[model samples]
Target: MAEADPMKGVVARLDELVAIRPRAGGGFAPGGKVRTHQLGGHRSGFRGRGMEFDEVRAYQPGDDIRTIDWRVTARTGRAHTKLFQEERERPVLVLADARAAMRFGTRGCFKSVLAAQAAAILSWVGIAGGDRVGGVVIGPAGVATFRPERSRRRILSFVKSIADATADAPRAGEPPLAAAIAHIRALARPGSLIFLVSDFFDLDDHAVREVERLALQSHVTNLFVFDPLEAALPGAGSFPVTDGRIVARLDVDRPAARAVYAQRFQARRDAVERMSRERGMTFLPLDTGQNPVDILHPERLGAKPSAAARSAR
Candidate 1:
């Protein structure tokens, strides 16, 4: 028998994703060292006085010197330390867009496939960390959502839904990724880790505002799934493309046509980046050609601890 091609099947297979586990747990280190992309450490729940500086108490045997309250120590004639604790257990929610734009890819898989693959990797990671897994798949057909759950059955169901939603092409009479982000706004809970996977072809002000609002309470990471061909033309040549309605010939050899075409994608990417930066959200660039698992794992990120927060983000 022959081994299966990673890209030939369901963006990503459940068995394949589950097979790749993190060396360490998906949580952060003992102290707090998160990557630049994350807000650092979980704060969903707390044990001691966190950041409010509630009060100072006599230093215990294992008290951290950095937290020593100088004024309180001197006045009390005894070393005292400030105390703060933060505890958290967050859910991972993946929002995938299978819109018409994501339906086209000039690589091993479609942008929708890439989106599903990325979502599956994150879902398995969340399961590894003991977090609930859930997702929303929005495509030409409409929006499909799954509530976060820690059960394997729930995670598998969500992945299947994503693949099914993206399996078909855009119909001529479909609406524009209807109520995609709006659905997320309604489903995502505070302190949850939200992954938005999409080509963002129709990101209007309304969509932007919904994401912005969701990020205010939940951690939102924008996973822009695009194809390299969308970023640049294949040298100087003529290519044929379609949006399910009209099949058009693109003559990249024409003057400035390639530049204009590439700029359109660049501009949208730029806007998403600017928004992400301003909000301290994580932005991961994934193309249909790359292996989504290697690029998205919590430990494999450019920085390990930093990558740790990507799942949390």
Candidate 2:
């Protein structure tokens, strides 16, 4: 088989993504560290905290003091405790960005492909954890939304939607990132876990507010995906860049230009991080050069896997 062109990594194939299912398991965790390229760790406090009242029974040893049922104890004339069970099917939403800006990369694969791959891996992990998986893919054509479902079939369908979104052509007058965030705010239920994978090029004031609102109801993890070139210029020289429609010359040779470019990128990152920090959400930076599977793995993220993690893999 011929190797695919790295320059033309425009779309993500369904079969290719499906093959990643097996590798998606083992040590992966949403709050895992990406210990490479100076990309630090992320923290997540969100869990299946949604508990339902099971019953009230006589208090026994090891019963939580917080769960003590005072009314039941008073009526029964004995110490009682309320038992609760965690919700089994917590909804997990993977929001992937497949806009035109994501179609460019200098290593591994395009940002769009990386976003889809990450989203697919997260979806598989969610399903494996006995949670419902769904997603929203913001493509050049528009947005595609899938409701959360616990079935593998539903996850596969959602994966296909993400793959398909990458192949769509850029359309004018399409909905912005804020619109998609707004859509997710409406679609997501309280306590839902949302993984937002994007380069965040379109994240503006409106999108920031929208994300803030979304974070209030759901646990949002911002996976900021970017290519190495976007963060810094390769050495110092003139380079040609294009935005699908127009081509322009980028003079990285000028120190002022390089400084400005780096500052802009840092500003964008700082803004996203600020939003995440304010909302108590997780903010992770993903380089296109890094493997999505390794990045998500709890114990193997850019590090030597432990014996237990190796056995699981």
Candidate 3:
């Protein structure tokens, strides 16, 4: 099959993403509709701790009897009713990595591109559900901020700015993962939903600790995008590397070199997954080679195999 253009893929996928609506609940239901309450915003009212029952008035003609506060009515000697306070809008932040290192793609597309796509989808989802959506794109130039807004246009603008900002970066870099995490911690308030997108290749223990701290204050979703080739280098012959003037060919066929690189990659991935689990975050493993929409909409992949079926493999 002919490879699709990356830019074209992004545009097409964005269009498809706009069409998706959350199910009746916030989760994706069988019918691709999310329950209204689950959409994650103020429309559902505040359902959490801050919510209080306002004074009940006489039962309105249409008021549900279930909501009547009988004890209040008995004490007041009137048909006083209960009114629960509604919730405020929940903020959702998409913390995306657009570092140079994320620009490499041995197979599929670049991790940076995938991160952008994921951010776009997530931002749109949050906005659609009536939540305030904002984010920061971390690249070599530093963190680019997009304050949370409910407008669809704002979400689109955020996604586009991220794409434009990272377009000029080199395909690799020593990203400041720790600094970015700290930035997120400062920017986001408690109880926000944070979607952290990255290859998570350069993150050190300090960065991971920062992420953990953020997790304590917010619900986090870690989306790890990587190329399969990055995990396992093919048994190809030595490949030539040119540093403009100098040309050097390094043999990857050597078992030691191959093993070391593979181990490092695997270890990084494992650490990321473990951290996510420990922090009670949802960890999604995505391959850049796969369709972006499919990754976001996993149900489209088909019925998930049962544990027995998966284990048999």
Candidate 4:
């Protein structure tokens, strides 16, 4: 029998990721100790096609007859149209980084694989919460975008796009993060939530500016994924590592080198945190060694019951 393709196991899996949907009940679960309650679904803080009635206004020439406020019209003896603030369907777009730099992993999976998994989980959560789900995958070749929509077909299409785009690693000459942000900035309108999942290795000034622009119009969330080793190397002598380009041995036994390595990763993470805080975006630092589900839904783990579960109790 031929040996199995390691990429298949390591890169991305739609089925398993989608299975985590039921875990996504409510709120914006992040790295912080406390919970975050974000409005979506019925609580979505947007005005659009919804069932809830906002007010009644004088009937305009183009007003739909189906939306006539009969009670108000009969009482006031004037034509009025029911203005309903449709509980807006929140749109969530996942940006996955699958460039060459993401191919390396020391533990559970490569950075790119973790990215795909994180995207899938986000997609499923959005779908579960009655939100429009879509994504953009930034691979070596280029980028693939799927329009956000609330339908089984669209959700499946987004998942398939993510899987296909990240199936094989590609080499991107320029910094893919900036381009990905540009795509998101163009697509994002008000009432949209954008999730950017990456190791954030070499984020430049251009990307930070774009993120700020995006935050101005919509909610921006950063899911920074990194290998544990990248954060801190154990004092276990030389460690082999690669970023798909350079294969080198890192001297973990050297305290000075380890401190510098840890500081480098910490600085990148701090940058993301600072940016997110200043602009009111949610930032979650994901460890490759940790479970994605746990990062997304920490309330479900161990002895703690979910908020809903706690309420029922």
Candidate 5:
């Protein structure tokens, strides 16, 4: 008999990551006001295509004479001009974190695995929507970057890098969260859609500033990946914990200890969520116990995993 793979959920596989491409269709496309001039499906904040009618208002000096609404102008005995919304393609960049801290998980899969799968889905969705796909994978081995390109080959290479990064062992001199974010910002062009997928164990003020810089020109979405155990200690008990080298026991039975543990995690999560909202970035929690596909595409995959479940300490 063959033995089961011990690192099943801890390490991601290229095949599994590639398989998520098909499921990336439908409700996976992000809706937003992009800042690009390229023609595409998503609507841009500026008007250009004039395909969809916005409204007819009083004609201004700079208004296009061809857009003058004759009917409305005749009715009110005044000139009126029509406005329309322009649609354009947005570049999608997934900043996937496969850091050492993301290697641990209590349910579903490791944070690294969840981040990788979600990254793959986002990349594919961007390709399907006619947007260029690119990203940066932050792992123990360091940062790997990919330039935005509207090609399946580029997405495959990106997914493969994610899988490789997740399976790599901890190496010295890995880039910090702030540095990684800065790199991602540099890679992303103005008006690109960026996905920051990580457990976010190192989102300090410096990292926050870097993200804010990125958000100034791009639409940023922070995907907070966490495990059930990280959110709260298990019910009253002494749980055994280890990191493959060091072993310890958690006394969750103690009320004070449990309270402190839960409070610390909640505080961190809250701070991240609050910062994202304040900066007008989308914040979505990705629990390891749930499917990334379902969370990313709730309308197609059904109701998302409950937040209440994670709250029950």
Candidate 6:
């Protein structure tokens, strides 16, 4: 038999990373305690096409007669009725950042690799949950968009496309994160769920504001993927630094360099968290060491009560 492809192995491990719950008393858990709520199996929130009762309003021109609530008309004795229409399925767009900086990682794997795994796992969850999944892959080469589609096959294809895009890309200048956010705003419609995955190292305040603008129209999930080394530098002595085209030696122990590095990393993390909270977006900080499958699974994340557990309840 032919040996299994490593990519397939990586993808098959999706279940392991799905729904990884933050440890009890961990900083990531709410109130520093992991809630025991079960989640998974059955869908959460709105599902399928059906008119939901919004609110009764005065009759307006071009309003569908079928949507008019007769009981309201009888009670009020005025032209007022309930409006309803087919509810749109939530479209999930994964905005992946494949900039050059993400190409580096001192532990476990490259940030780019982790990003691909995260994107694949999330796509699987979205597809399995009966939602459409699509994404825009941005790199130095350019941007490519995969239209929202609901199918296991399509999701797999999307993952493969991402893998291909990052395989041979040169590591150089940073890509335009703000411009990509603008593209997402233009392409995605209202009520869409956008997963913005990036290390977010090169973004400016203006770029952050632009991202907030995109979040206004959709549910945004800011997934910050980072390597442990990014948070704390290793004790390695002075090392040579290269800008791809130029090389120079710098002391890692320099007080200014150490201070600047720590400050920059912390500031970026703080900004990302602040933006997420301000806009009501889900902030998922994933370390490269964590399993992607666990992160994608809702049950493991304590999102909702599982079906069996709910029945027991």
- TM-score on alpha carbons, each prediction: 0.72, 0.74, 0.69, 0.72, 0.78, 0.66
Considering TM-score, which of the candidate structures 2 and 6 is the better prediction for this target?
A: 2
What value of lDDT does candidate 5 attain over all alpha carbons?
Answer: 0.76
- Among all candidates shown, the one with the greatest lDDT: 5
Clashing pairs in 4: 49-86, 50-86, 50-87, 140-170
The residue ranges of model 6 lying beyond 4 angstroms of the native Cα positions read 1-87, 171-174, 239-250, 297-313
**Candidate 4 per-residue C-alpha lDDT over 186-247 given as tens digits, one digit per residue, 9 for 90 to 100:** 77756577889888776889889888877654566688888887788788687676654688
Q: lDDT of all predictions, in order shown? A: 0.67, 0.72, 0.65, 0.68, 0.76, 0.62
Clashes of each: 3, 0, 14, 4, 0, 12
For candidate 6, write residues 129-243 as lDDT tens digits.
5567788877767677888897767766777666765564575654588877777666675556677888887678767877777654455667788887678665648777553
Whole-model lDDT, candidate 1? 0.67
lDDT of 5 by residue, 178-245 (tens): 88898888887655778899878888999988987876556677888889888888889887888768
lDDT of 3 by residue, 1-313 (tens): 9985645432224443344433333432111222334533342221123367645567655355677789988988877657554445457788878776776664455677777777776776666566778888788777778778878788877776777655654544544888877877777765566778898877797988888887654566677888887888779697775433578986787888889989998999888877866655656678777766664555553424233212211
How many clashes (backbone atoms < 3 Å, residues ≥3 apart in a chain or on different chains) does model 4 have?
Answer: 4
**Candidate 5 displacement at residue 32 in angstroms:** 5.4
Residue 242, candidate 3: how far off, in angstroms?
A: 8.1
Best-to-worst ranking by lDDT: 5, 2, 4, 1, 3, 6
Question: Positional deviation of 289 in candidate 3, in angstroms?
Answer: 1.4
TM accuracy, model 1: 0.72
lDDT of candidate 2 over 1-313, digit per residue (tens): 9996643555799997898774323322332322222111212223222356656767765455787889988888999877654433347788889988888887888899999998888887777665667878888888888888978998898999899988888777867899888777777865577888998998988999888777654567788888888888877877887765799987777788888888999999888877777666767788888888754653333334223223212
On TM-score, the candidate that comes out on top is 5
The true-versus-predicted C-alpha distance at residue 210 of model 2, in Å, is 1.8
